[model samples]
Target: MPRRVFVHIGAPKTGSTYVQNVLFDNAERLEKAGILIPATFAAHDQAMTDLREVPWRDPEAYWTWDLLAEKAAAFRGDVILTSEGFGAASAEQAKRAVESLQPAEVHVVVAARDLWRTFPSMWQQSIRARGTWRFEDFLAAVEKGEFEGFWEHYTANRMFLRWGDLVPPAQRHLVTVPPPGVSHDLLWQRFAGVFGIPDGLCEMTEPTANPSLGAPEIELLRRVNAALGDRYPHRMPYQRVVQQHLVKAVLQKRANNVRFGVGLDRADWVMALAEEQINQLRAYDCHIVGDLDELRPAVMTDSHSPGELADRQLLDAAVETIVGMIGHADELRQMIPPGHSGVLARVRRGIRRRLG
Candidate 1:
């Protein structure tokens, strides 16, 4: 039989990191089980790039369909590819991606979360990636549809709908992220089900804690990125390493930190819009794998109170993220051998030296 290819096209912020990390960390084990996750440093980047129409200069723009095709062709078993940013691609880009995979039975799996939560997380992510806008202002821009022009720019539900536009209804599998109270394993179960993997075979691994910016942290990020914006735009990976890992880590570890999420009023507004979109998606006859009620937004409660932390705590968290990312840094440095050890690697090494 021709290899059945499963493509998890992320709508972003739905445990994509955990999923990708698991696949990358266990590629050999998975391959032995007849599932193949192509080995590529850029698998996540390329999958997202193939779906979106972004500026070529963007770091994520490095993802290319031609490369993905080459990787797909080499797979010996059922192929699985994933990237959340792929939700942003234009119809044309989506068509090209499907065409590239030609002849293979392509199954597109999308994991979506409620907008009330997703919007804020997405905003923080942008800020971590070098965006300078205030949370309130960022929400306003998204409300005004200011970011609609770029492929993969933030649109609550618009991008979610695009998966349907790109692939046939029969081929699309829409997986809803269960609310916070549900076990995290719920997501993995649904994903495995779609791929025809037996339940309980793949262990539910701990996902990396991608700390969301509480209001205070968001404000701090805005200030830091504003100071750094002229020096580095969001398109640069080096900038992401600095802003996301180094700076944000310091702010989050501060004592009396607030948890990240929208204020009640704003969360309500975004959730209302999300509900409208969810209803629209249901109308389209999409194959939803989880309960829609579980997708509804609830009141935002502070997981932590605003407080100060000892400087040591702040430094520790930042150091951890930096250390974790060093492998990526090494890979990056190897690519640009002539480039200086760059700010990210330097900062990581600096943290380790300080900690030691």
Candidate 2:
């Protein structure tokens, strides 16, 4: 039989990071199992180039798609292409993606979560990306259809309809996130089943994943971005300090043990929208794993209002950011050349001697 290609298209914020980390970490085992996830992390970049609708540029952007397809055609094992961004590709772009991986039996896998559960996290992600809108205003923008990416990327009903336009319903697989209170690893099990891997076949490579932020923590980041407006307009520094250090390193540590959810007003509309999406998904002749009922948004009782953050809460978040930035500076200090910093070298030697 010819090699099979499984395209794990994403509707992000649905454990895509966890799944990618597993696949990339256990690449050797996967190769032994006759499956190959491309070595480079530019699958989506290549797809965007192929789609040509988005003005994306990378040094290798022009040839990534053809190169991947060529590699798949030459390899004996199955090829797996995964990127949550691909889940938002238009019908034409998806067609190009499918064609590029021709000669192999192509299957698309989509991992999704309940709309209500997804939005709060999505809103937090936007904040991490330097968005200044509060959760309420974000919801208002979504309902008004103001943000192009809101419905296009986060809404399952729209994403599936676009990707499924070309791929047969049978070839489209929907993996619904199990409702909370169940095993957190269940989603991985559902994902691994696509490639016939047994449960626990792959282990989580990182100790912690891309954790979510509490409302106050996210609001703090937004305020910081607003304060730094135009001063750090470049995407690189913002992504580095705010996204990498502030959000991931600092805020995630402080934000842990805190949970936030969609508010009551947002809940009703989100739940109704989730139900409509679930109904539409059911109508498709796709292979669905996990309980469809899991798509129903559970009653979220502990919602936090960004507007209601106490002065102390904001101050606490700011203090944590300062401490985290200090720690990050220490890490950077360690990375400096020993010849460049005699003080750091002596400090390192003292620490090493103490450990010894």
Candidate 3:
């Protein structure tokens, strides 16, 4: 049989990072078991230049789709294209993605979570991307249908149709995140089943999840985004610092155990909306793994709101976050090799010679 392909088109924050972590951690073993993670998730971004409707100065991007295809085609076994972003592609873009990986039976796997729970996390993600919207405003944007990406990602009813538009219902699989308190690794097991991987196969790579921020921690980051407005016009520098360093290295460490969730007022609407979405998900003819009812989130009460937090809460978070940045900066500087320090290298050398 031709190589089979399993693509985890994400509705992000639904264990996408964990899934990729497991697959990548056990890449060699998975490959030996006749499965190929064709490329890193970021590498696939190059393959979507056309789908993004963006211009590419890098010639390599022009052929990245083909190159991804070539890697898949050369592999003798199944291929896995894992990216949460893939879950956001429009129907036409998804069709293009499907076409590029032709001559193989391509299956799509979507991991979905409770809609009400996803929003706060999604807002945290937006803040990481330099959004200055307060928590309440973010929710307003979603309800008003103003937040395009949020609508596309959080609505399983909409994304399923778009991603499964061309693929058959049977091959379009849904993995519902089991509600809290169940086996944590159950999500991976559900995913492994859909991807045709044996459970506990190849030592079953360590379970991992992305770092998350508490409400106050995320609020602090949102304010920081507002303060840094227009400073780094380029995406890379900001992404390198705020996203890669500040968020990951600093803010994430400042998280209090206090979980963030929708307020009672927002919960009323979000729960209602999640119910509507769940009903719509029932309408899809796709195969379902795990309980679909798990998508219905209970109204959350014990939660912190970014807008409603006390000044003290935010001040405490900010102070620690600042300290974390300093410590992290020092830690990073320690990791740098001595000779790699440019002109500082000459200064240190002269000091050492005088001491000698």
In order, the Cα lDDT scores of the candidates are 0.65, 0.74, 0.76
How many pairs of residues in model 3 come into backbone collision? Answer: 0
User: Which is the better candidate, 1 or 3, if ranked by TM-score?
Assistant: 3
Please estimate how well model 2 matches the true structure, expressed as its whole-model Cα lDDT. Answer: 0.74
Ranking by lDDT: 3, 2, 1
Candidate number achieving the greatest TM-score relative to the actual structure: 3
lDDT of 3 at 296: 85
Rank order (by TM-score, best first): 3, 2, 1
Residue runs of model 3 more than 4 Å from their true location after superposition: 48-50, 54-63, 233-235, 336-356
Residue 216's C-alpha lDDT in candidate 2? 72
Judge candidate 1 at residue 145 and give its lDDT.
66
Candidate 1 weakest ten by summed lDDT: 302-311
TM-score, cand. 2 vs. native: 0.85
Evaluation by lDDT, superior candidate among 1 and 3: 3
RMSD of each: 7.7, 6.3, 4.9
TM, every model: 0.76, 0.85, 0.87
